[model samples]
Target: MSRIVYVNGRYLPYAQAGVHVEDRGFQFADGVYEVCEVRGGALVDEGPHLARLGRSLAELAIPEPMSMAALAHVMRETVRRNRVRDGLL
Candidate 1:
């Protein structure tokens, strides 16, 4: 199965997932990322992880990529599409 990734509000095959060269995250590393573990098909410490992400974005003066609910949906969908039952997301 092709690995799926979420980018810019769309879910695409990993091979098709591309970030713009001018993206701040890629150019200047001006972004924050959270790695949440998945166990038995469920996220671990999801709330804390997201909260920390919000804080990080705030510290960096970056606008939120999406609402919390939307972000959560994206995370869950990505994990489901990738079929990751036990691994880091």
Candidate 2:
């Protein structure tokens, strides 16, 4: 199956997901990320991971890409789209 990815505010197939070459994250690594594990379709330590991500962004003076709630929704949606029940997310 083709993997799905979230790019900007849309979900697209991995093959079609592309970030601009000049995007700040790509050009200067101006962002923070989190990799949370998914077990039985539930995120592990989601709260802590998000908190850490917020702190990292703050430390780097980078704006959040979206609200915490929205980011959380996206994370869950991405995992669902990929049908990942137990794996790193």
Where is model 1 more than 4 Å wrong at Cα? Answer: none
lDDT of 1 at 64: 93
Candidate 2 ranges with C-alpha deviation above 4 Å? none
Tens-digit lDDT string for candidate 1 (1-89): 99999998789988999999988889998778789999999999999999999999999999997897789889988999889999999
* Residue range 1-89, candidate 2, lDDT tens digits: 89999998999999999998989989987677679999999899999998999999999999888988899999999999999989997
CA lDDT, every prediction? Answer: 0.91, 0.91
Clashing pairs in 2: none
What RMSD value applies to candidate 2?
Answer: 1.0
Using alpha carbons, what is the TM-score of model 2? Answer: 0.93
